[model samples]
Target: MSTPKTTVHYVEDKINSWQTRSPFIILFLASLVGVATGLIGSLFQIGIAHIISWRMGIADSEFSNIYIKCLVIFLITAAMGAFSYYLVKKYAPESGGSGIPEVEGALLDLRPVRWKRVLPVKFFGGLTALGSGMVLGREGPTVQMGSSLGKMLADTTKIKNKESQHTLIATGAGAGITTAFNAPLGGILFVIEEMRGEFSYTKSSIKAVFVGCISACIVYQLIIGSSPILNIGTYISVPLNSIWIYIFLGIFVGVIGALSNFLILSTRKFLDLFYQKKEYFFVLTGALLAGFFGLLTIFLPDITGGGFLIIPNVIDELYSFYPLLILFSLRLIATVICFGSGAPGGIFSPTIALGAILGVLFGICARTIFPEYDIHLGTCAILGMAGLFAASIRAPLTGIVIVIEMTSSYILILPLILTCVTATFIAQTLGSTSLYSEILNNTLDKLGIQRK
Candidate 1:
């Protein structure tokens, strides 16, 4: 018979304890976390680029015979996807999808950070899934891995201060985005804006975020060079007369962003319903989707892969209205399916591309309609990216900063702000909650984790 106190203690809810008076030590550890995150993020970026290049090379050149080429591509991609899903299922299920939700849950003490399992699984699994030509981004995995690294260091160093741990994790996450997109300020703002209610903002925590972002930026620049993430050439600021046009663009992408979120949530529930009967089918489904997208990559590469590389082309108006529309529709579907299927990747890159395409399409019509005013199509594409991101993530400031940083289009800050803010307002009015927050809530509910 167990003692009453022991029984009570065993059943009691666990809480993370906090401490103070270690600002210097926490700052130092935060820098270390940023460095580690940067190194891993850079390597992850390089690895994915290599795999994508290899895959594209084979598709473009090697197998002259169509059947043989298709077979090889399918086999390669299917194997990659299978391996990624297998790792998520066996080693770390928390790494199954865009890891941002898990990190958010961790921040609020609603989830566990199994770093030992998450680090390797997320690094390799994300690499394989994104490399296999899925419409996914590396940023999500990097962020998750960064938070894990923070927790790993805390655990190893025996840092029992819960507040310090939270700060470190926040720092790591901020640095991870900086490394992923080469946007230090945007990364810092992301932590402040997107994580507003969750983060315990303090003087030391803010300083730690800054230090971590700068360190991550430096490390990433050392490895990946100091260039912006996207090579979309800068454009002249939109004429005052044309600024109002972007509001329409914002409204359009906002509605689409809401629909995208709905689709993602719906797909997850539908898949889970079917998956409950046969757990083994999950990996099979992922591999099949990868193989299907691999084939699509050969036929029409625009709709396949993360939307980063295609941004420059879209900005340049490479695709006409009909083709761009088809590409956008196909990619929207692919992005939602790939992300919703529990693949360890992100929706950021894909969303950016879709927004750009949609923006360009809208621009084509706008230019024709308003022949009196000079409108820049590329600028419209950039506005699209910012607006959609702001709408989907509900972080207008972060979206504006990240768009400017990624494209180095500083002259259009005013337009970016207009688009982002309007889009956010429209999204909120339409009842489209934050994507990551919704994902986190759904995830916690599914796991039967209650938080008040």
Candidate 2:
């Protein structure tokens, strides 16, 4: 028989051993989340591509009646949008809109993660919304769904620790971003910067994020190939003297980014007046918006979709200044409408496209004013991509790293840092809140959850 002191010591040792091993368990789970997110995200991308290609192929097929072809396309896209909206309304309202805010809320324990509903709802709904040519991104759905998967694993595996749950959720979110953009470091930085407040940042948690990001990237590359998302030709180093122009561009993007945020939030609020938490009204609004975009996509393809296709054209100067300006204006409006209407998509790619447009416009004018510098317009476009993201998201590091990784333009780091930092500083100075934070606050308010 053991003495009382020996029994107590034995129990202490057992507890200590479990405590030491628990982190490894959590890390292993995080890696699993990463692999799952990567495969799902890749499949999501493939599905969207097939849908888009099928739609375009049909549109281009030799048909006797052109008007009928157009009509058929519009009807098909509109139906897709309607179906996606219906799913969100009936099955998972929380899956509507960019799911990033929801993940952030979940991390803070301010929201619940119903993965069974969210996974299916976000996956299919996002496919429909994106395929319908809405100015939305896949990243939002991927991140939300990934985080939901993490939560599902935790619950199923009986991970009772709150901190562990938070870490896994964040890991999945980071991995989702990695899979979406093929930027592992950017994904890791996203968790650190964008989700800073909610992310635990413990040694084990950070390592888990790393593992998840790497795993997600590996899986994504195996499926999607290792090419950068944007294949804009390599840009030469920006001249040192032209750094001032980037600063000015940064300031410009800061104002525009602030304006963009205001428009997005304002539009969402206005739309909410009609929705009033009525599922039918919300779904109807989304469908109507989708229908409109479907028609627009058939006509002005430049301003529709998630904005990736437009970036290369913009960087290549395919459109002159006037047309670029017009495209930018239209896309700004489309982005606000699609995102504010609560489509199951993200504003991230749209925002980056806007920045590229704005940067192109600025570059055009700059070249006209200063012919001596012979500035590379592509550089400006690149800077704008990071600048606007930095200002709007208030996550400059992630923005910079993302731009660098996406473009493979590490030589432009100095200019990127200058522009992104300036944009973020100006946006903050102008009293603009980070986009995700604003969205999260709005969500919590709607749910009547008070912040601690």
Question: lDDT score of model 2?
Answer: 0.89
Model 2, 1-452: lDDT tens digits are: 99999999999888779869666678789889999999999999999999888877776778788788777877888788889988998999899888998999998888889999999999999999999888999999999988998999999999898999999899989998998889999999999999998887788899999999998999999999999999898978887776787889999999999899999999888988878767488777766777777777667889889898888889888999888888999999999999998899988899889998999999999899988896888899999999999999899999999888888988999999999999998998898999989989998898799965
User: How many clashes does each candidate structure show, in the order listed?
Assistant: 0, 0
Model 1: lowest-lDDT 10 consecutive positions: 13-22
Give me the runs in candidate 2 sitting further than 4 Å from their true place.
1-22, 277-279
Clashing pairs in 1: none
TM-scores for all candidates? 0.94, 0.95
lDDT scores in order: 0.89, 0.89
Task: Give model 2 RMSD, 1 decimal.
Answer: 3.2
- Taking the tens digit of each residue's C-alpha lDDT, what string does model 1 give over 1-452? 89999877765523112224445778889899999999999999999999999988888886668899899999999999999999998899999888888888888998999999999999999988999999998889989998899899989899998888888888889998898899999999999998887889999999998998999999999999999988877688788977888888888988988888889889998988877889788899879988888888898887888888788888788888899898899999999999999999988888888889988998999989998989888899999998999999899999999989999999999989988888888889899999999988988899898855
